[model samples]
Target: MAKARSASQAASRSKQARKPNSLKSAKTEHARPDESEGTVPLELQQKCLTIFRDALRPSADDVAVLQEVKGHLYNRDFAAAFAKEEYLRVYASRWSPSRALGYVRVLADIQDHLLPDDELARLGQSDQESLEIVCLGGGAGAEVIALGGWWSVVTRSMPKIALQARFVDIAAWNDTVETLHKQCVTAPEISKYASAAAREANRPMLSGDAFSCHFHQQDVLDWPENVVHTVITPTTKLVTLFFTLNELYSASIPKTQHLLSQLTAALPANGFLLVVDSPGSYSTVSINGAERKYPMQWLLDHTLLSDSQQKAGIETAARWEKVVSDESRWFRLPLGLEYPIELENMRYQMHLYRRLATKGDG
Candidate 1:
């Protein structure tokens, strides 16, 4: 009888724990439909639309506040240089200044593969003989030094070696210079190498003369035409592209091909092009295709490089390999207030191309 009573109590508890069907039916009746069936209040819908419109609009007050803050942090003379559209594009994006800094850190890690100390020593000796080295899309110049430490080392070896270092970018040229200065002052290791470079260049350590780094503020498409004719020589050793290509819109692929052709045309036999970009694993949008994929081999076929350039390029090319082939690295952000849709499957590739030896070459 006691066991029977206990079993009865257990059953009673189970019944109490279960929701009644009548209650479930009531909930179902009140719940909103998955599809809007013109049942939603028009006034409520209009209110939501108004809120969204306001959210989308950039307020002048907010702009003023942001500008004041940036001016304080950077400098008092800082003006809103970028267009409102461009500013919104960058500001609304998930890639904030902090994210950009994180990306820079990742770039630094990858650059480690490029200029191992021994390689720097060898490259230094080569530079002493007047090897022209140019960095394309050199953002902030951090990756340039981090990967091409050989440049600094070579400068130290041959102070009189005429080295032409050109930094190319579309915008933020002054900001890049400021960033380089900040890094030189704040980052001790980078500062040491930079100081050494200045000494080798026969410039004063802390003077503006050390700021001889050339800045080219031009579209990448125009780069080869504008600078290539003037700067490129047969002895040009290295050309680098770091973390800049991914920012390009996918529609610019043809433009990219044109740029590659221009680079190939400019580079002498035995010159090299080193490209580093987000891995293909990152998601990208394509206008016609489902998702964009980085065609690395296509880029390789487009460029000119020698055997040695190809070898050096490959050694520095591993960091971006995973990004080009992996799908996991790519993701889509929300379009305004909409939910994030899966980005069309897109991939990235990093490449190093060497110019082949010319006819009658040794």
Candidate 2:
């Protein structure tokens, strides 16, 4: 059984609410630079919250649907929870900004610890002269926004580098994904309900750039090797599973393993794999005749760090260099942050691996 009422559940509870299409409160203050450690720029964070709050206004009926969606997800009923557009809208409005900021924090940490300037610049030197990222289960735009936020900062001196982001999930998230992409790349239209001061403050979170995003609505496990190749290309620099790996494992371990293997094999040397998930034993799997629970981080370590697959008679040539591993990292909400709904600070475990050059490679 999965951990009931995980972080997502906590994120769904709004600390404040108002009539539809309005902020939870009119008071907004600037964030302290020292607080976020500069991972998420204060202005960008405020803009991100504003964009989501303005774009996905939830009505009374939508709030009811949000509660239903939360219950279904808590029960691990993903099919039912994400089956409707209303569910996705309410979910995104309620939770995405905080999750997106969480990813911004994680990506910045990776840059500081794992990737240096020259190495990150090389990501755009592929045949197409572009940087590519694949996000598994990234439908709600957390990964998309994170990439945009991070890229915006890193590419200030290298403005010509283009980014191509692909979001893969079972739900139809194209609309939401595009909406976020647009909001990040362009100045958001000031909401009429916004106060005059807010209208003056509204602007693009990130300056315009050559960023393109595409959403693929398919079961990642069902993606054949050929399909995987199309998505995770040689130009790919990053593949992220932000709070998504456990759900994949719970869906089907064999298939999730297959997908991971495919992704690893498809990535170019020096490409990175980032896995973020809720901590503790939230995933249940059956072994022999009984079901057992294992921590998501442990499972990933066993599969990617150790040669347990070879020991189990499964032949694989995957070689990865562990760059970062943490069992629990906290991303607290920035102080003075205000939104239509209160956002929960995220505590997640993360693993980052760099694909090593295999034998016979140049």
Candidate 3:
């Protein structure tokens, strides 16, 4: 009887040793996709593999192509260079295409409210006057494009108005700048904001004869005197401060106030300042009945615009007149689950202000 018991114990030990390591195992032994079997579906596994392949393969190609295309190349060489840069940039940057696409889909959902048919017709008018527009602290160019869409509604129907635009940022991702340039030159819908024909006709004015748009690499606090001289000239009619003041405000409120003072001094009396910023609050929005809290109000309160500036700035007649009493226009963008991780916690508002006339008005 003792010999039989010893043999049985030895067999149990051998069976335990044959089992796989819990920590090293690729899949959990007890977990199941269907909840009945202890295994994942074959289709799910294939889907994961496909995603991994797509991400890894494109990333490898982007690195290779970007390296190969470095330095100046002709227009024909640009396509290949751009393709590689875009692939790497989109993947490498904080905002991914999949995420941006999701936001775009949301915008498309509210297209009628954001951009109505009458607005589109007004944009297509032929007699509209052009404006010299400068975008301050513009990042990634998405805000520029969105605003451009609104400008397009005003320009598409109005061909006489030539929109001469300049974008200034502290630092720009090469891929982002390149993408914006391509969209400006090729994409008709995007070009409609500035009237592509006008841009083609006045190509020299568009990018300072560089065969590129005016994209400057400069810091906002200590902006180059020469660049400021060029932009604040008598011709500049509109200045856009999009999502830039928030960074400054959060870092140092005093510095932001000082910068705003300088900007106010630079603008002509009749010139327009369009400020777009994130709101400040934990407002909840539902998507498919799922509640998500987005810090909408907190973003706005932390922004650079002071109460004084809000009250003193010139106002306009915009749709958001009730909520945005101090400014002419106010707009908000909803937060979605599919929003890029970078923009997930924020909502945006557009503030349009006119420079108040001084005692010795020019």
What are the RMSD figures for all models against the true structure? 22.4, 5.5, 20.2
Give candidate 3's error at residue 207 in angstroms. 14
Off by over 4 Å in 2: 1-37, 58-61, 112-115, 120-128, 191-203, 206-209, 308-318, 360-362
lDDT of each: 0.38, 0.70, 0.39
| Superior candidate under lDDT, 2 versus 3 | 2
Position 11, candidate 3: lDDT: 20
What's the ranking of the predictions by TM-score, best on top? 2, 3, 1
Candidate 2 lDDT tens digits, 120-236: 567545445676788887888677777787777777676667778898887778898888888777777756798988977765655655688998877776887888888888878
Q: Candidate 2: minimum summed lDDT over ten consecutive residues — where?
A: 1-10
Give stretches of model 1 more than 4 Å off: 1-129, 144-150, 153-163, 178-212, 223-226, 249-251, 281-349, 360-362
Q: Kindly state the number of residue pairs that clash in model 2.
A: 0
Candidate 3 ranges beyond 4 A from true positions: 1-88, 91-129, 187-212, 224-226, 281-346
Candidate 3 residue 19 Cα shift, in angstroms, is 40
For candidate 3, the per-residue lDDT at 289 reads 88
Better of 1 and 3 by TM-score: 3
Number of the top-ranking candidate, with lDDT as the measure:
2
lDDT of 1 by residue, 71-98 (tens): 4324312124232333432222211221
lDDT of 3 by residue, 78-173 (tens): 224334435335332322222222222223333454336764455446353345667675434443343333343344344344555676755443
